[model samples]
Target: MLGALNMGAFFALVYVAAQLLRTSVAATIMAVSPVAMMLIAWPLLAERPKPLPLAGAGLGLVGVVLLVASGSGGVNPLGVAASAAAMGLSAFGHVLTKRWGATAHVLSVTSWQLVAGGLVLLVAAVLVEGAPPRVGLPAVLGFGYVSVVATALAFSVWFTGLRHLDAGTVGLLGLLNPVTGVLLGTAVAGEVLTGRQLVGLALVLAGVLLGQPALTRRWAARRAARVAEVSPGSADHPGSSTVDSRVPVE
Candidate 1:
């Protein structure tokens, strides 16, 4: 089931949507997956969504919307539906993986999921598209890169992250997908970055930074220090020496 949701169905639906929708549009739709994952993880993994990360996710989502709004074309209903399903399934699968709690090695778990999903995708392809078409050397190389670098290596790191990070934090990091896409278009495709896109990029970066565990912890610590300083019996308080202790001291 994990394999089906994350690997097979998610990839299949994404391909289907990509055929009918613009890349920016599809990517923007997929950007909501982090929020979905956070919600799913709340109940399934008993991981409560922290306020800072939730706020950052909201900010990042807004940034993604701005990044795509200019380039998004007319929406195809089927494509939109497919994209939404892919997002939901992937989020569910990710949260489920987290819920399972890293019982096995990350590589071992990733490999098994890939193999199971690959088999299902292979059978489906044979049925729907008949025999595989012959491809040039370039195409074979591209496939090799995707299989090795994109799927195998990428998923290994992703699962490792899930084991160590809060689901909400991991989800917020996924906002980078669309950010990378937009930046790649500017750099690789020679597309000009508009002012709105620049602002969106900044917001997305800010959001990612805010959701980082270290930053969140620092902010929490600062807030706690402030509270302690203002409290009557705190050491930093001027009147603290006047306050009597409730418990007997040695």
Candidate 2:
């Protein structure tokens, strides 16, 4: 139920923004979805977080800021509003995905949401745009790629993974999107990544990677304890340490 509304809102907003905002601005604004998810999770879910996730959230925000500042173009009030709506709703959807990760059937849940969203988008296209404009071959191909590869194949793997993972873990995987976007922009679209953009990207990557509990700080703790136990002090003492390094420090 929640996924339907959230995913539906995202498709609608993305469609509206593509029409309303410059491509650069639209691209940048899209980065907000992940950050918004983390923020929403902080408030709504009973999930614990680590430094990296927090950092990723901060970096994601920086990316948005840079993207906004890079454009001196007059702000379209509609675009801004639509973008905000998209992120906020997306956050809610992610939280729900996480909440139902173990129990719900990811494929079924996603399928139903896509069906509902597709209908809404179809209706919206008809009402506002009066049918899609005559798309060129390039645009047609692009749409085909989006629908076939991005939507169908991508989500198939995504939802399957969701069924076996926590929300944060799933969210962390999404960090790849922005980085991939930047790379694709550079290679395919000939857009350059500026110094600020690079920094922002680094920060965003760091945050997302750091955010997951799976990549917990326990590693360093375990290593340190192992070193301590094996040090001359412990080895000099009889029966000082029998615990495996994997065990948490009491």
Candidate 3:
């Protein structure tokens, strides 16, 4: 089921949607996945959403909307449906993996999931597309890169993150996908970054920072220290204070 949702259905649907929709439209739609994952993780994993992180996610989502809105193409209902389904399935699968695979080795789990999904996709491909088409060296190289770096290595680290972090935080980190894509386009393809995109980029970075566990822990620690200073005593014994009885007698 994990394999089907994350690897097979998610990838298949994304490919279909990408073919039908403009790049910006498809990417913007995909950017909402962190929110979806947060919602799914709430009920499934009992990871209650934190207000600051949730707000950050929302801010990042709005930033993504602004970032991609400039280049959005005409909407196709089928394409929209496929993109939404891809997002939903991936989010669901991610939460499920976190809940069920808590004790499993990350790489082992990833390997099995990929293998299972690959087999299912292979069978489907044979039936639907008849046979694999011959590819040139560049195409083969691209496939190798995606298979090794993108699928295998990427998923290994992703599962490791799921093990160590709250699902919401991990999901929020996914916002980097679109951010990286836009930056890469600008740097590699010579695409110009507009002012709105620049603002959006800042927001996305801020959101990701807000959702980090280290930042949250620091914020919590500071708040706790301030409360301690204000109260100056334990809640159970409000006015009581501790003193060293071993001091020299006055």
Candidate 4:
């Protein structure tokens, strides 16, 4: 079920989104996934995002819109709806993983989910797309990279994140996926990165950083320490007050 929703449905709807909408528009709509994940997590995981992170998620959305709009592409209403559906399905899958796999080992959970999704994709490919025309060296290497590094290792970390962090926080990190994708396209796929894309990337980074609890805590602690040092109120010590709010207590 997790695979069906997250892997299978996610990919399937992506195809649907592509067919219904322009590629850029599809990507833009899919970019709303973090917000979708947040909404899904609210009831599924009983998770509520902080105010700043919520705003950050909204900012990320704005970035995605800019990124897509900056590109030259046609748009469609149905495509927008399809992309939204894909985003919702993706978010739903993430929430389910966090909820149902709460106690499961990350490797085990990710493995099973990927297997299920792979099986479904395999069946779909055989039925609809037919056999591969050719498995050339580049195609084989690409497949291996996506299957191993992208799916196995990457999703392992993602599943681990779902286990440890609130869904909203982890979901916000997903915005980085597009940043990586866009940068990769520019670096390897011969795609151009427009000013809008750069702005979008910046917004996404700012949003994701804001959504990090550990980072926020450290900032707060540092701010408190600065205040203590400047205010001259030695609440914990004779000369100065030390407030350690960093995660891991390091």
The TM-scores, one per candidate, come to 0.88, 0.70, 0.87, 0.78
lDDT of 3: 0.87
Q: Which ten residues in a row have the lowest lDDT in candidate 3?
A: 235-244
Q: Which lDDT value does model 3 have at 198?
A: 89
**lDDT tens digits, residues 52-116, model 2?**
56566667656555533454768798998887777667768767766665566766766767788
Q: Which RMSD does model 1 reach against the true structure?
A: 3.8
> Model 4 scores what on Cα lDDT?
0.81
lDDT of 4 by residue, 1-250 (tens): 8898888877887787778776667766777777788887888777765676788789887776766665465677777776787788778888898888988888999999899998998899899988869788999999999889987999899989888888888888877767787888899989998887889889988888888988767877888888776674665555655564663554
Which pairs clash inside model 1?
none
Residue range 1-250, candidate 3, lDDT tens digits? 9999989888899999998888778877888887888889888988888776888898888888777776434799899999999999999999999999988889888998999889889998999999898999999999999999999999999989999999889888888888888899999999999999989998988888888988888887888887876675754345757555776657
The lDDT of each candidate is 0.86, 0.68, 0.87, 0.81
lDDT of 1 by residue, 63-107 (tens): 988887754357899999999999999999998887774798888
Worst 10 residues of 2 by lDDT: 62-71
Runs with alpha carbons beyond 4 Å of true place in candidate 4: 71-74, 185-194, 215-250
Best by lDDT: 3
Off by over 4 Å in 2: 23-29, 42-45, 63-69, 129-141, 189-192, 217-250
Stronger candidate by TM-score (2 vs 3): 3
Residue 191 in model 3: lDDT: 97
TM-score, model 3 to reference: 0.87
